[model samples]
Target: MTRESSNPKPSPNDKIYGITNIKSYVPLLLDLDRLNYDSWKELFKTHYIGYKWLYGTLTQSVLQSILKPNATAADVWKTIEDLFHENKETEAMELDDELRSITIGDSTVMEYCTRIKSISDLLANIGSPVLERNLVIYAINGLSHKFTHVVTTIRHQKPFPTFLEMRSMLTLEERSMAKDHSRHVQASHQDNASSPTILTTEYQNRPSHYRLNNTRGRGGGRNQRGGSRGGQNGGRGGVR
Candidate 1:
């Protein structure tokens, strides 16, 4: 049997901050570029540290595509920028399409709003930030038909609600509608359950001759009076 080595292989650094995509870290990279340009060597040490962290964080495929032997932080940064910056328009269009096509469906108001905000953030990073008014409109348009009244109410507001405020109102409306539907279902079930008992009680309380008396009319009342008078006359004749 071959003897195994007692020393364990070192694990990858878990604490290193990774950049998953090019869009999110552009601002940080730009700040580093400004520092590098000024020749702030003391401050530039931080950039070197960040560069190593980035190298460790990047996936094998990304590293293979962008990595240059003995590359400076600025070099790596420029490579990432060149790759992503060229495709900014395509990315922006895709994000815009995603924003426009969203519908509430089975998602809660909060969930729907969160998805919209996420898409907005991505668009902003690509230099196509959505306007606040347009964001509000997109949110309203994506809601279900049950929210028509809420949409109308929002539209009539003078200043209109912010995204957060609108989300809160919609969530409240969703809860209220759910509560009302629950009550209606419970009421329908109660009515169905009690129907047999109600019918039985009504039948039991009915008069024995109700069916026969129900057909009596104005002529029946006149006949009853005439019979009573005839009975009185008959008694008088018998006495005579």
Candidate 2:
């Protein structure tokens, strides 16, 4: 019969204690890379320009204050440092760069990363508003009622009766958006069929323009960077 000891220390190398046990960190980073690249690819194809914003010191510093148990930057920093075994300050300059290269292969990943980071910083300064929240603002400005009338007539139904109903309904504004998007898709299809397609993105790579062009003596247009990302629409046309 032995009494339980009160003073027990945990092992430093325990699975839950050390950063080395964080087997999923690298995987999470990979997943983020894939998601970001896919999103960039689709946006590029759609001719969407990216932008960014930045967070102010006070609002961002206070962001953790309303958490369930309450928190501070110090607390959050400690968590990162303890889990990653490094100084978190060195991690957050209020800005960090992590962007991938475009598949065009003309731009360096770092140059594009700088632009993406600038856009992110811009978003931070604006304190992003949840999209639906702005509907009321639109309503106050009269745009909502105009669309509401258009939608009711098209659908042969009553105006938006409840927010829940709005969730599944395609209102007039949405219809217009869909119509515009469909037109763009049709236009691109026509353009691609026509050939000499100057394309964009970081997706499942189409194909390299040429491998070892100097050795192979291939012919092609040279992009602005003098890096060989130029070629025919559906051919092997990428040079690094």
Q: Look at candidate 1 and tell me the lDDT of residue 96.
A: 96
lDDT of 2 by residue, 123-224 (tens): 332332223323322322222343455445434444433322333243444566668899999999887773233433432244465445543453333333
Summarize candidate 1's per-residue lDDT along 38-151 as a digit string, tens digits. Answer: 222333334344556455534455566678888887888677557556767887898899888889889988889988998887777666889988899999998889999989
User: What lDDT does the true structure give each of the candidates?
Assistant: 0.71, 0.34
- Runs in model 1 lying further than 4 Å from the true structure: 1-50, 56-64, 195-240
TM-score: which candidate is best? 1
Instruction: Report the error of model 1 at residue 7, Å.
Output: 41
Which ranges in model 2 have alpha carbons more than 4 Å from their true place?
Answer: 1-9, 12-16, 19-133, 139-167, 171-240
How does each model score on TM-score?
Answer: 0.59, 0.20
RMSD of each: 12.6, 28.5
The lowest-lDDT stretch of 10 consecutive residues in candidate 1 is: 31-40
